[model samples]
Target: MTLHRLILREIRHRKVNFALSVLGAAVAVAAVLSTVGALRAYDRETEAVIDEMEEATKAEMAKLEDEIRKSMKGLGFNLFIFPEGQDLSEVYAEGFASRTMPEEYVTKLAESGVVTVNHLLPSLTKKLEWPEQKRTVILIGVRGEVPIAHRSPKAPLIDPVEPGHLVMGYELHRSLGLKKGDTVTFMEREFTIDDTYEARGSKDDITLWMNLGECQEMLDMKGEINAIQALECNCATVDRLGEIRAELGEILPNTQIIETQSTALARAEARNQAAATSRAQIEAKEEQRARLRAEREKLAGWLLPVATLVSMIWIGLLAFINVRERLPEIGILRAIGVKGRTILGAFLGRAVLAGVVGGVIGVVVAKVVKLPSVDSGPIIESGEWIAAIVTAPLLAALAAWLPSLAAAQRDPAEVLRHD
Candidate 1:
């Protein structure tokens, strides 16, 4: 019989041996497929988790930004820019600046591309006697905000006072028994009360607001302003006031800038806290992903190799047993002038056949089986399928190599005598 026929006969005669050998190969292939699938699953899961984290972080950041914006509006202007020669002690004690700067100074600062400040408001403020009401009050003149060329237009923090109208303080209007739409005369100019403010327990309670040009004309300080109120930008650094001062110095050399420490600090802290919270959340997710990947790698690192080695050893052991059982057949064939090469081919062929069958079985099991670790289905690639099919036969051949070689080299005389 030919070597092919011989191999078939041997497999048929030893069905148990062939089945066991095929089982070993199938086990190895399945182990490899499971390990690779699990790792791929982990990678996919990590990507999905990172995507979710980014979206969540963005939503949280937006919410924090909205909250900070409302808080800033409540805090109001934090920086006061006035003439360099003015004394801050007097300004604080009297609740208004005594010195005056050119109104154009505010325009220069706004258009200077200075990014450290926002909401530039030029106002001419003074404590004067209301001749018509026979009482003293602080008068503040305001106009529309100057647009910054480099920044988008925002809603004005303090609305502009319209001409011929007045926004009176709570105490001023209450004590004078004035209400909205009532005519009030100040500095010989007639102005109608447009609105009255609620109690604020501050000098604002005794203050009167009017149009900038009208106030300047009445005070005979046309084109001049005593103060420029602004809100400082919430930058990452703590030296924001210093930076604003430096920028303003270059633009308005005769002006001095002062910061409201409580408001400025609170704004900066709120922004910083929001940023830190977002960063921490993303970092936590990244660290968790890294940890999971390392664990999966460590598990697969030993698992695949251990499984392969055990299958190889099992196939080799079974081949050795098959050789022992076929010694008499080998002896009879050798005596009839069958070459050792034919004997070797027969043994190796049987192993290769078993390998091919086992590989097919392994592929099917891998496709059907679902691992607990992987949430998604089995991730089998074309390359993995090829490796499973190709590696199995090679492993089987290698396992049977030494046993087949020993059988081929056995002496017919000794084999027949032992049989």
Candidate 2:
């Protein structure tokens, strides 16, 4: 028989092995595709979260700057005096009042007539906005100390009129639905929201405000205030917190210096750094996981095609072995004049027929059940498709080559001796 006929005969006879190898190649291709798909999905989600954080950061920084501007009015000094005609000597002696700043400074202000202290109640506009939240809007108290008067009504954009009146920010006023001269409640007490003045670039414009005396009574914080934002002579003057703490200790010994900026900023920066580090670590772990997952998927992919290749090779092996076993038959043919190349050709033909049938079956099966391409990564490249298809066959041919070559190497004389 012709060498081609001999190869075709063996392939047609061993249909089962031919079928298995074709299936194996299809599985490997699918696994490769699935891994590429998963990476694409992960990239999109992380991008959105970063954008939200950026906006929030800018808003918070603006709040800090406003607090600094407000605090600058105090110039690190203020003098508190008794009410008009109240006789400071008696008030000082009777223990009803005590000076928090330097006693000398109060004397200087009183002598110069530049510093004056007065007590009055007034309502403040809301500084924060929350829809349907009129009740949540609150009036924060301000002091009528030197810092308060030194406050640039023109610069901050707050309109502080006579006793019992304060300004509101446009943003705050619009939210609370209150108008100038309107009334609002504080601790169930009432005051007029008068003379709304614009505080440039501050959300505090919404705050309807009154003097410290009103805040102390309304908030029920008599002799106790939540915070003090005294103006420093210079932003440079309050460089070190320890110095501020020491100077504040000497000036306002009993009052606590609560921080809205320096201390808070230090802690915030530390936390931001830590969060960045954690995100990087998480990203590292994710990258490692992606690699591992890809490997497992590739392995899973090989199972079917590899099994198919092994089965087909085994089928081809059995046929070749049987032919080797029929040495007397093979020897007679050789003796009659069949060439060694023809004998080798016969075994190779079996592998080719099986490979083609299996490849075609694999290709058809892969096509029918073809999974849609999954999006993977921020950028999926075009090379992946070409690589997967091209590699599958090369692997299959290699798998088929070894066993077929082994079948061809047997000595014809030895095979005939067995007969």
Candidate 3:
């Protein structure tokens, strides 16, 4: 019979040994694949979070840029000066509440002949307690021209507020559930709502407007204003705006002159924060991946090797025992002129077949097993499967080496004499 037929007959008779070798290989492969799967899942989750942070930041920055740019047109290059420690993003979005400058600054700014401007509006802002809503509302006081309310053509413009009357923003009016002719108490005094003004998709829509003098009296800030908004001359360009900023710097050394380019600065700040968030996410994920890598290395370097080594020992012992049990058969084959190489090939072929079978079972176990603790399921790589398949047979051949050699070298004369 051919060596292939001989190997098949041997495997059929040693079914128990074949099954044991395959089971051992399967267990080792499953362990390694499970560790790898968890690490890949973590990597996927980290990427998702980083993508989300970037997307949200882009949307927010785009909206801010559009709103700020739209509000700047026909409004001239307005300069807003705020307190040094204040964040411009928050100030520009929601008007400043704390007094940043004295009322005398406005008078000095207007009187400065070196800096010629069309108009300057010195404004005071405070958060007034709303007992009904259990929150506070933004109250802005404009001393000079009310540019925003007047320029907005769609606004329901009101005549000058006579002391005890209030001009509310349309949004604020809707939020407070108030109407014209309604009385609201503020600073222990009640005032009649004169009308609601429209500012069209600006923060001004959420504010309450009053004359600067009346606001000061109500807030007890007699000679204090928080901000100064200046409308540049009609013929002014970007260079002229810079000249105006220089003049303001010489006049108000402690105050910062912020032009419309604050929008650009805001955009830059948003991008920087978005990049920082992405970096943080990547770093955090890398830390997690590092930990997983360490664990996988431990399994690969120690646990997997130990399991494989045990499998090799068990298979070698079984092969040696099989050689002893079939000594007479091997002797008879030798007497019939079978070469030692053919006998060795027959034994090694049986081992290789067992290895292949075991490798397949291991791959199946790796894929089918469920790990409840790991939220992301196992990832089975084709490379790993190929490696297991290719390596298992080689490992089996090595294990059966000594047994096959002993079987090949057995004395046929001594075996026949004993029989």
Candidate 4:
């Protein structure tokens, strides 16, 4: 009889053992393929979520920037000019003395015809003592709208201040034991508080604001202003700022013109940096997740190879026992002129057939079974299935090699004598 027919007959007769061997190999393949599928799927999903969040964050930032740009309408032309002797950095020093500039400079700027001057607001500041309150007060004088006022949740738009009225900073109002309609004595003159503003979260928060004429009279510095904040008719741009600076240089050589864009850019850069930090944090989280998945997959990856080794061992053990039980049959076949190679092929062929069967079942189980750890359904790739199917039989063949050789080399004379 042919070796193929012989292997089929042997498998049919020992169906239970063959099925067990196939089942063992199938379980191993299923485990490996399933874990691989789940890990790949999870990685894809995590990247997708990260990408979506990044896009959403960018959109939100753009919307905020657009809103800020829109709200800044008709308000981007501020040019702060300070006297030459008083540097900008000196204003931040604890005991720095400030020098005032001539009030006639405002007239010179308007008269220079360099640019259209919309509003020329001159300001003065002085460090004063409120002896009754036992506190140092920052007294500010403004000829036009308050430069530091901004709309916030706690503070809304302020009404234009009348000449005699005083507006206290939000924190300053809280610190001073005074309120609207309360009388306060400064420089031997009594003045009533007209309004208390909300906290601006800056130096202005602790400052007191009043009319330019009142401050000039109180400080005894008439016709002398420390700084001038002007709103020009044209847009605030690099070119326009340069033109303004050149014009100011020609007219008021002792003053420095400061454009407001630097401060705006600083604020914008801070926000963008914050957004980038958040995005980095999110990406870090995703990367950590991916690393964990890889670790888990690495751990899980060992299971199938170990199972395959066990399956190979099991097949080897079965083949060995079969050879022992069928020694007389092998002896009879050899006696009847069957070649040793054919006998070896018969045993190895059986092992391969069992492996193929097991691999098929393993692929099916991996594709169907749902894992608790994996959120998505069973994921079995075609390549993984093919690898499992191909590797199983090869492993079985390798396992059966020694046993099959032993069977084929058995002396027919000794076996038939025992039979």
The most accurate candidate by lDDT is 1
Model 2 misplacement above 4 A: 1-14, 24-264, 270-274, 277-336, 356-419
lDDT of 2 by residue, 181-213 (tens): 887554445657765655455535444557755
* Total clashing pairs in model 2: 28
Per-residue lDDT tens digits for candidate 3, residues 1-419, read: 67788777777877887677666556666666655665565456556655775676567656654454435532323677665566777766655635367877767665665434545667788877756556567887765444332232322112345677787877878877888989887666788998876656665667677778899887888877888776554332467677777878787776877875543344345556655765676677667766766776665577667877888887788788878888999999999999998889878887787778878887777677766545666677889888888888788888888998889988898888898
Better of 2 and 3 by lDDT: 3
Clashing pairs in 4: none
User: Model 4, range 352-415, lDDT digits (tens) per residue?
Assistant: 9988998899888888877776667656677788988998888878888899999899899999
Q: Which numbered prediction scores highest in TM-score against the true structure? A: 1
Give the per-residue lDDT digits (tens) of candidate 1, residues 1-419. 57787788878888999999999989988888977876787788778888887888788777776667555644545678889999999987886789999999988888889888777889999998888878889998999576667899986666789999999999999998999999987877788998998897878899999999989998999999999877667664557677877877788889887775557677667767877877787788779888877987898899889888898889989999999988998999899999999889888888888788888788778777778867875678988888899899889989999999999998999998977
Per-candidate TM-scores read 0.66, 0.40, 0.55, 0.56
Off by over 4 Å in 4: 63-262, 377-381
Q: If ranked by TM-score, best first, what sequence of candidates would result? A: 1, 4, 3, 2
Ranking by lDDT: 1, 4, 3, 2
